[model samples]
Target chain A: MKQYLEIAKILKNTHIVGPYWKLKLSVSELAHRASSGQFVMLKVDSDQGPLLRRPFSIHQVKGKTVELLYEVRGKATEILAKMKAGQRLSLLGPLGTGFSLCDLSYVPLLVAGGIGVAPLVFLAQNLRNRKGLAILGAQKKERILCEKEFKATGFRVKISTNDGSRGFYGRVTELLEELLAKDTLLRKKAFLYACGPRPMLKQTIMLSKKYNIPGQVSLETHMACGIGACCGCVVQTLTGYKRVCKEGPVFAIKELTEEGLAE
Target chain B: MTPNLSVVIGTLKLKNPLLVSSGTFGYAQEFVDFLDLNILGGIVTKTITLFPRQGNRPPRTCETPAGLLNSIGLENPGIKVFIQEKLPYFQKLKVPLIVSIAAQDEISEFVELAEKLDKERLVAAIELNISCPNVRHCTKKSNVKLIAQDAKATALVVKAVKKVTTKPIITKLSPNVTDITEIALAAEEAGSDGVSLVNTITAMAVDVEKRRPKLAMVIGGLSGPAIRPIAVRMVWETYKKVRIPIIGMGGIMDADSALEFILAGASAISVGTANFINPNVCSEILRGICGYMIRHRITSLERLRGAIMC
Candidate 1:
């Protein structure tokens, strides 16, 4: 897809859940061009203090509007949180390879942990016609995000919280293992996809491999350019070092090494 | 009437004065989908060594106030792979291709790399990257000192590479030094055609909460708008000491910054960290420079070079 650099007007900026801020932007070109799992490099401020552009996944797209779910992590995000509606943000994107949804035979299963649900929400929205399952995980009930959004898509949504305050008491991977073991038919047709913290992703990859199921993962890394130029976000894959920004924020289960999964 | 933006660095003549800094613009192919390669003054390939380097471990980069600290460790495919796999792609480009090469501890390795690249007719010039702050010399005696930090070592490497290739040599110097002019003079005396300064400043960042270094390598090189003034000052100092041309780079984000380098006495300027902010930044900078020239009615950059009225 073609990328663009345009100033997007902030349509809405509100706190979604604990620590998560949802930003809605009016950028026609990017809203139409961006696909599931693609991201934009957002310039938070015009000043030199927070100079580097921070990468944000396209949370949702409706006509000329795009949504981004971010947490206040550092100086840049702190600046981004203070932005009010009608403010303009310089955005460069529709960049990097997005999630591939070509196979029609397998059952789509989206597994997410905490804020990693950002891109999966976009993925789930695009799979409205397909009968899929979403396993959303968080530290506690309050941290579980996009459960309503995923369920609204007419997909089976499962919640897992570490504190046992939600649907499942243990990790998402354990719940996945239990579900996969009980459904023999699902074991054959399940196509697992995940995005989350390193430990969760590694466990998910391990579970996927044990079941011999086809899977894809969206990765996160500290980036500079978000394009292939910087080489800052490289992850060691089976094929060697690959830029997580350009080659992927998403990769197939087999393409990554266990080290990459942990990273 | 258009202003003359073309610049001559040593034996090579560029169509303009906006070369993309090495390492920032990967082998020239990465930007093809985003920009027309022909518009650039030149393309400098990433620094290559005699053998493949698998760079530093993860968390290689961290964003500072207006800068970026990177400990990439010069990860590159060895010279052999670059010639066989990468050079052909650069050869097809319409603009001049300057190859940047770095050596471990031995000067002979630098000579070997120069000899191998000398046969490639597509190479417009050779840029010796003796000042990369990311990698340290493995030799026991060198004690991890960067080659550009010592004038004698810089001269020896330049003279060794100069012996093998007729291609104009441009020594890329580091800013993390006491006197940059001494290094520039040494390179010029050793038969370097021109010089490019300054490579990223050696720096470190900390995650105060975690109480650890941000990068795995502990210290990396700093680049961005933060280093522009220091780079301009170094260029001015180096320009006064050396007769050869100067390619000034460091925190060059726009035409104004590029012009600052030119006015401070850089014959040419490179856009580095700004390329990360905007992929089309180089072209914008080129146009900005042209617009400034048209407004000032300065027909040639030669008239304005070093015209900084003290």
Candidate 2:
């Protein structure tokens, strides 16, 4: 998608789960052009103290508005948390490659871990002519995000927590295994899409490979220029080291190297 | 009336004084969809080496207060691939194209790359990068010592490359040394047409909890608004010593900062780290420079170059 540098006006910044914020922005140009799995670089403050713009995945886009789901990780997001409605920010976006919605023949399954649900929620919203299954996981019940939002999108939602306070008392990968084992039809027709920490993604990719299914995974890294100029966000892929900012924040499961999966 | 923004560095002429610094601007293709590439004075492609470099491991960059530390280790597609794959795209650009080259220990390698690029008609000039601090592997050997840090080494490399290429040579100097003016003088005495300073300051950040360096390379180059004052001071000092022109860079974000470099005695300015904040920054800076000239009723940039008062 084409990139744009725009002044996005904040409509609301609301606290969702612990440490999570939903910043709704009135960015018609960016909203109209953004697709699922794409991201925007946000300059949190007007000053140059933070220096670099922070990259956030496009959580949800409805008509002329877009929502960003982020955690207060550092100074930039901390400043974003305090920003009120009517504040303006410099946003550069619809950047990197997004999830492909092609091939409707396979059943869509979204696997999200903790804050990785940001992009999956966007994908769920854009899913048409199909009812997908969303497997959401967090450390505990309080850490789980967007359960109702996923349900609102008409997705069959399943929850897992490390503690026994959610639907399944185990890892999301284990939950995915159970679904595949129980439903022979799902094993044959499922196409998985996942986003989370590296360990979770590796496990999810391994599970997909084991089940003989096709899947895509969204990766993250510390980036300087989200526009591919900096080459800072490179990941070692099967082909070679590819820039996550340009080639993908999204890649097919087969493209990633599985050498360090045990770690 | 539109102010005459054009300036000449040696035999090479630029449309304006605004340039996107090497490394930060990539190949110039990355910003084409966001801004017009023809509006700027020139474009400096990232530093190219004789051989392909994989660069450092993960955590290549980190942010400090108003500064950025990067240990990219000059990751570049070697000269052969650059010519075969990257040069075709740069040749289509209307603006002046300055290619930055980084050499290993051998002066022969520098000459070889220079002779190869000298054949390309699209190349307007060559900027010799002798200042990169991120590459740790080059530090062990005396021959591989950063050329900018040693007067004799700097002269040797510049003289060798100058012998092979007719293109204007601009030596990029490091700021980590004790005296920067001495190195700039060395470049000028070695037949360099111009000099650019300063490459990122040698600095390091540490993860206090982990008790380890933030960058995989242990130390990286520090850049951003934090280094602007030092850049201006070095340019001002170098201007007093060198007869050749100075292309000043380091932490330039906007027009005012660009003007600061010019007034401090830089003939041209390059916006580096700021490009990450705004892709259209070069155009914004160009317009801002024009507005400053029109408001002050100045017709040319010469009136402002080195116009600072004590």
Q: Which candidate leads the pack in TM-score?
A: 2
In Å, residue B150's CA in model 1 sits off its true spot by 1.6
- In model 2, the Cα lDDT at residue B39 comes to 93
lDDT of 2 by residue, A52-91 (tens): 9999999999889999999888888889999999999999
RMSD of each: 2.2, 2.0
Q: Itemize residue pairs with steric clashes in candidate 1.
A: none
lDDT score for residue A44 of model 2 = 77
Off by over 4 Å in 1: A261-263, B138-144
Q: DockQ of candidate 1?
A: 0.60
**Cand. 1: chain B TM-score:** 0.98
Model no. 2, DockQ: 0.63
Global CA lDDT computed for model 1: 0.88
Q: Local error of candidate 1 at A75, Å?
A: 2.1
Candidate 1 lDDT, A1-263, residue by residue in tens: 67888889999999977789999999968889999999999987756477788898888999999999998888888888889999999998888898988488888999998899999889988888688999988889998898889888877899898989989999988889989989999889989889988888888888888889988999888899888876788888888778889899898988986776544
Model 2, residue B131: distance off in Å is 1.1
